[model samples]
Target: MENKQINIGIIGCGRIAQTRHIPEYASNKNANILGYFDFNKQRAEEIAKKYGGKVYESVEAMLADNDIDAVSVCVTNSAHASISIQALNAGKNVLCEKPMATSLEDSEAMVWAAKKNHKLLMIDQNQRFAKTHIRAKELLEKNTIGKALTFKSTFGHGGPETWSVDGGPNTWFFDKNKSKYGAIFDLGVHKIDLVQYLLNSAVNNVSARLTTLDKKDSTGKLIGVDDNAISIYELDNGVIGTVTSSWTYYGEEDNSTIVYGSEGIMKIYDDPTYSIVVIKKNGEKILYDIDQIQTNDNQTKSGVMDEFIDSLIEKRVPKSDAESVINSMRAVFASIESNETGKRVSISGTK
Candidate 1:
């Protein structure tokens, strides 16, 4: 069906759904947002009224509608797998927000459910689609900087308070029960996925330190999860790197990656004028003028929602498919374990 349009239902009417998923999907010619469901009925109704979709009182009600061929699971970190699995079992493709699930087991289950139901399962690891990152990946593939030796990738911001729909210290992001882990999952996962994608390798070992530095709840106590995290990773290809995530960056957001290679170094988003810069050992410098990476404040076409729609229409796996992202999730889990156990944690399998 070359002219087919995929019907979509959004599972949660949170900030991400409203800001990213809804707008992007609405812009895709082959995707239609037909329904919306949220824990708060009024919120769902509000979104439906503004976005031209039916409001379903419950997730089950939304999934039961056969007209919705796909659903975006934009809920809490803990609920991602369960809701996405439910949608998959109901014969709907799923586009789940990043940090796919709270646990590796849950992530695996979501992948399995999609395979069993023969539905597409795309993870919203939008970093892969960043124009700068895409160019960096191509350069790496071409050995533009020679074999990568080491790297550092970081994603930090003031906090999720201003970004979440309910802006406050007590936002669900700081709640361990709802978010499981804080910055490591919220910001770190994106870097982990991006580094792996850029290097075309899997992280096989991780050592981390996670700490709660500044965030406090309404009761004036530290939040239940870590606000800052730093991890050392060793990729299976013998490349070493450091990944850092934090909510304590009180100034401008810092989402940059620098890779040191045998020939020279490649910097992404580290320079104000150039999206990517390469300096060779021979003192030759190459610059690429690409679009800035998407941030919470400056929203852009993430290319995730569009990719999900195209995957459904083309009958192919998405660029950020469920199975492909498991390795990145594995690295995040390893980092957590390393922090808890005070030792280096090795990823269980080779990617």
Candidate 2:
């Protein structure tokens, strides 16, 4: 907030930091990378070497730096809430990677921390900024899609080991203690957030099946976390649908989402050839050529970090602020419950 420039620090110099956060923040005039911190100091040092930031010896040291104004929490899923909460209580704005946390309670605590410190706590749900998805939401809101009914979404890619920094089968992404769940928590949340965003709905219940059908660790053993998940959700508005996430697509990555309504069926990311497609109830087809959706594999621009900085400077809450984060967190935890109990679990979309 000093001179409209926010000094930024990064907690986890892993793949996402390099692939998304560090580069994206570097391109913005208002956000400055003050330093980096990682359990592996060498990794942090390496990022600072190329990106122009000092390396912190520990999270405590980084948090104690009064010069730093904000921090990006891009560690594994499990560390998101803890780091973000610490940053917020340290009086620094926080832009945390998605899934909010492994559980709803952690996410709630994170929100509480943000409120207690009067600092920004934003979850980086960047798919909402995808041109196709943005256009899809506009159409839905304008009734270009009429009364929404149901939807189905799928997000998949080759396993994370390939992209994780110095990765192997033993990367933190596959560890249950570090990642919580594989494709479910990692990729599934992205698709689910887009679904709720476009539909303007909140999940009321979820039934899910999560599995590790094929992924294995270096010892050729199945990792404790899941590799695939399929969930059926019923939203408060009576819209019902299925969501799928997997680390075994083994083909071109699939991050497609389809929404159904009385007037039309809207499709997004369904075709590598098209950004969006819609078929009206009367059988008329419409197509939109917009920016392609960003994938971890793609370097297309992401507006998440920039948006966070802008919001902080303008004294406004970011688009992916705490309330939206908690709702998405509710949906995620419900799916986890459904998977564990093999029963449809209820989600309370209330405070």
Candidate 3:
């Protein structure tokens, strides 16, 4: 029921926790953020103090505390499976960040671990929660974009340096061992996931060309990870799409997705605002601006976290749960394979 507050714990007090999770959880009255755990004890303490919560030394300690109803694994890309699996086995529901895992085996294990423990496993693919994205998805489903033809989506920002509070080599975003596939995995995951989410389909095949173009560290040294990447995919629904993700953009935050259907075209962008533009076959264009739907802070779909809390209490599937995000992971891994082999990779058995 929505009458009681659910106890929540966060593992990995990194950029995600500091910016999104902490603020969102603190503002939501339905969830009680009991505390957080980070490898960096000082960072954990800082976040907990700021949120009126406590810091636990380890995930086990946090999970052992009976008050924690759920645990958010905000750790690195590689550790998502292990941390979430450990939390699930400990009888705590888990909400892990994107990419599920860097590889298929780990991703599947994370899913299986949740099933084995009968715990909820959610992937924090919050792009679908964006008002613009949700509105576009609705319009597509309503055939407002006509018989889905093809789509192009891209997410480009000025690298993770500006995005993270603590910049430089210290940031795990630059660690290949932790981050997996640079921009392709970091930013591409959202685009791939949103495509599947909006189309209600799985990528049937994928091909990619990856590059570490313009790689430069804080000191201007060459970095090992990729700075720009592109992937082409064919959805099971027969819709072909292209997804480009980069950490090399120099100006303006650009996250835009456009879909062209037999009847018209639909576009959604993040720069100007969270809004959707649809053009009908008759050449009539309609723009549904979500400026008013935005919260006082201009954060769109700030209610998604609340929705997750409500789903937990209602014993229902959360929007960002594994059942959906697994498809995104499939697309990511398949794209990686395509890049490595310089050929199209078929995503067989993917729904």
Candidate 4:
């Protein structure tokens, strides 16, 4: 298998599949897309025609194809677990999209299926692969900044309407049945996973406020899911931080994370001139002009696809595997519980 290219199948032909998964897999030398499936057959046909793959009549057909060594579960949030599980059970590795699943139980089930089938289950937590974030993690690991105390991480944009395949107010993102969550799951999950990865700590407590601020359906009614979320997290290591996910920022996107340590503060994607900045207690400042963080408008090769392919060929677990990302998914659910109960939720033993 090391010398053979992994045959890939995409389960959804939505915006994410077309823009990120398909192109990334096509660029990887160890992978080749073999099939495509979507609820909209025409959409699947179009993607297959453009990307050099066969269109499947149904997801079951795609999963049954013995030629496909793995499948990228790029469907809606609610279907992620079921489809991934099916692929795993069918003897194919799975690379699931973010938010893994709508619930912890479903996520665990996906992991269980992968383990039972002895297949790889990787999640697309792309933020951790960004050059800026990789550098920040290295700096933190090296103690470039002393003990990290508190931090703020934010991911905001106009809305998913500008990014989804449908490209309107009626995209599945606003529908709770399809998305299961809005800004929190769509955007917050990425930061939550990245924070945990960088700090080497799991979030143990969460308090949050989720609201529907501006987005509405074509009928002018408020969307069923939250448009904005502000969550405060306390990690197992006693580091505290705030995460804000919003789809209402009308200006330029604000995707930044800043950590304050005893010796200095580390800022990522915050400064206009630098990709990362560190300020010491003695007033010494350091600036790093690394590559810019990838955005929706300026898409870059998310190291995710390459890593997934390499992991399969090397017969090793990927960095963002399902088990590793489960805690981050737990934090997202915990934040929702805090919002509904109007109290801080503890995720210490929920794992």
- In model 4, how large is the Cα lDDT of residue 105? 92
Compared with the true structure, what per-residue lDDT tens digits does model 4 show for residues 276-340? 99999999999999888888898888889999999999999998999999999899999999999
Tens-digit lDDT track of model 2 for 1-351: 547689999998888888889999999999889999998888888888998989998888999999999999988888898888889998988999988898888999999999999999889898988878888899888887789888889999988888888688999889989887889888999888888888888888899999988999999999998899999988888899999999998967988988888899888888677788889999999988887888766778788888989999899989989768687778888888888898999876543
The all-Cα superposition gives candidate 1 an RMSD in Å to the true structure of 1.0
For each candidate, what is the lDDT?
Answer: 0.92, 0.87, 0.82, 0.93
Question: Clashing residue pairs, candidate 2?
Answer: none
Full candidate order by lDDT, most accurate first:
4, 1, 2, 3
Worst ten in a row by lDDT for model 1: 1-10
- 1 or 3, which is superior by lDDT? 1
TM-score of every prediction relative to native: 0.98, 0.97, 0.93, 0.98
